[model samples]
Target: MNRCLISAAMAVFFFFLAWAVSLRQALLFLVGIGLGGVLAGARFGFTTGWRLLIENRDASGVMAQLFLLGLAAAVCMPLLAAFPGELGAALGPPSYSLLIGAFVFGLAMQVADGCGSGTLYKAGLGIPLNMGILPIFALGSFLGSAQLEQWLQLGSIAPVGLVARFGLLEAFGITLLGLIALGWAALRWSDRIAPWFNKKLFIGAMLLAVLAALNLIIAGQPWGIVYGFGLWGAKAATALGVFDPTANAFWSEPVNVRTLSQSVFLDVTSITNIGILAGALWIAAKRKVGAAEPRSLTGTQWVVGIAAGFLLGYSSRLAFGCNIGAMVSGISTGSLHGWIWVPMAFMGSLIGVRVRRRFNF
Candidate 1:
């Protein structure tokens, strides 16, 4: 019964969104649906993966994350370097912007109990807190983007692509080696870690990596989450006459302007984001996942979570991507900032976990 309802909902949504936009949008949405299913089913998540590694010393999730990065880098680097048109790399600069933003995002994710992708997928699964967090995350994303230009001016350097620094062969070689070492280290630390790979999760990880790479190929950019949220919020604010897209530096770009003018289905990331939500809902329901249990959000919990969501949004923009954009695609694309983000965010997550206990979140 649950599966049937999910399927029907997906079909109706696909038709309406497809009718409203292009076939490409429909395809992206399908990819998002797959991502939703895979994430929920496999228990794949950056935040949960990191948290498990940090708190429980379980390396399984982190190892899978590393594998996702390795495979994605192997596939995506070549395409980005060789095929420049349309398939552009997500190149974020290395600077204080990243250091500060990613750290705050790390902390916020812990407080909110979900990263960008985690938040979206869980909300789709009807997690009450995340359901509350999503809109605020969106609003925060808009506010973040609005201030992005000013933030970027704070001790930033131009984006550096490994392909540009070292030739394609060298770049791929370096990335592959780094991923290997990172994966090994993660497993070594976790006494409770399972085998090198789980058959079920391996397939899911590979599929996700491939889909993310395809996202780059089709959308002409790497997989990302926050931009779509920000765009949604900005659009809403504009509708309410509280904001103007034309004036904001972030929204003034040609591509951004086009995104603003068209239906959300026409926007690549947004298309996929909506897909992820619906897809996760479908899978969760099918798996007998209930809406976030009746845990009511207290006043303090709400304040903390909402504030954290806002920071997650603001910091993600300043840093150039969230977990998906900055960490996964960043390292895959061979950006130094991606490397920089990992440690900073990890340290922040450490702090966030401690803080979270206070709020009992």
Candidate 2:
């Protein structure tokens, strides 16, 4: 089918998904975000470079991320103004600890070859090992959050928005426009950088930002990812007698809190993550690349990657998102943790890459 037809179909599916899922439920939201990601890949003809993170091919992800991040920030400003006490309690003061945590998460992404959300998309497309890793990630996140609560406690930072003094549209518009301009100017200055400046990324980012903002306006919350997966995972584990009650308190009941947990999981965007997976699969099938092929990796690589995923997942829970949810999504919302996590995660990623190389991963 043509892009127009595909886009229209996806739009309808995602809208329905948003309405169908409940607050404090994120499976649907993750689906929606994943759909957004697939839409991004589709717009680019499922290029391997883009799909698998080749040189500058993945710049689309960066652009989309910047736009989304900015929009998130704009929305957050006014949110805090309207609910300072509440926001303060959940976010805490952004600190060095968050930075360290973020670095560790980033490192894990490198080792895993995908961030939390990225892994989900690949997993949904029948990447068997990703299937295994996803659950391990959940367990890790649960354990990490439970164990590192105290050390990471000092980094709670509340969100600040340019919107409280302004308005959502106004703030979002300014931020979005600024980013667009920056992207444009960056591309304009260097022809070599031209290849990295993807129009698809820009379009997808803006479109998703608008969609996300609208969802928030109507649904009474911004977009989020981890809670839905965490809750679902926790519930499943609890059912299986594998999860510990004391350690699993937050994981088992992420929705009960009056924080972003409820909003992230329960919001309309939950379906976005799911849709991303489906959309990626749809593109894969159309391109005749739909077969689920096993990725060949050393046994040692798998063990290390999966083990690292546990750390990554747990850190994400403690810090509020994996790469996409925390670093990308969290920072975009101006949560402060986003910036802190980026560098720290990069450090961990450097180590992770070396580890992968040592294991021939």
Candidate 3:
């Protein structure tokens, strides 16, 4: 559990990835580690941020998040524009599924006390509830993806890419303006005496923005979390004969089929997801002994929390992604659905905070 030992293990894994996989995957693993460290070290919880804003009128976390989005977009949009052929955005359709799914995901994340990245990092940090929720979340994601085709039948328009439509400078300007506006609004709604900034959160936002940009450059795609979870679930289900990839519309695609056949370390998202876990574990190992421990939940609380975790996975798939994927990656890359996802998810968070309170979580 020594920091040096953890670093050595991470380095060994990095070399293994470079030797066995590609250099790109190895570098991405490093990026994922950076992301995990920032998220864990900063205590940056998107769910907690929204809940704080709702309950205590605190805007510091929300402002930090807005800064992260703006900074990430400033870097990402140009890179995407420069290498349009090589880089891809986290685009998702603005459909009924998005609305319903984002809302449900918002609610579920609150009840579960973690979003996708939040859950992963917290589990890595040895949080009991999140560790238990991880597999259930994967199962929910897999089931949700399996049923995605049906959700789309409710009606969806084609995805809109802002950089493609408005040009890089225009899209970047719009993204920055939107984030600034949101920050302003958060401040306006905040408690008069509430602290508007935190040094740690600000630093975390800057580091995350840089790391996220690195993830996009190395992976050739925006950073994501849920797809890896869904893939894990699919792999498990397929191995158990509980699911058939050929039968599921989403999994039947040639690309998906190929992905299913390959090792998870080869998958861009999966590699990063694993790296996040490892990085967070590294952070956990560095923490002072017995500094804090996760609170215990009653049996009923555990059941509700676990069920919410399942819903988090299912709704994230339906919503096209979670806080990290849909909101951060999507917005940073100029996807319109990412813009739409925020308000809906926030609305759900409003109700979610109430539900979380009712459950005394």
Per-residue CA lDDT of candidate 3, range 270-322, in tens? 98998899889989998887787877899988999999999999999999999
lDDT (tens digit, per residue) of candidate 1 on 114-195: 8888888989888888888899889888998998888888888889889779978998888888887888788777774355
* Candidate 3 backbone collisions, by pair: none
Which candidate tops lDDT?
A: 3
Ranking by lDDT: 3, 1, 2
User: Residue 302 in candidate 2 has what lDDT?
Assistant: 77
State, as a TM-score between 0 and 1, how close model 2 is to the true structure.
0.68
Ranking by TM-score: 3, 1, 2
Give the clashing pairs for model 1.
86-220
Question: What TM-score, computed on C-alpha atoms, does each candidate reach?
Answer: 0.94, 0.68, 0.98
lDDT tens string, model 2, 1-361? 3546766766665465446654323344444644545444534221122222323324454455565557555655556456644442123236545666666776666667666656666665556566678788767765655555475556554554434435556655665665677456434433443456466666665666565544444445445555555555555565688766555444434443333234333434344555565666555445444654666877777798788767667767665666655554554444445545555665576576666567765
Query: In candidate 3, where is summed lDDT lowest over 10 consecutive residues?
Result: 286-295
User: TM-score: which is higher, 1 or 2?
Assistant: 1
Model 3 residue 336 distance off true place after TM-score fit, in angstroms: 0.2
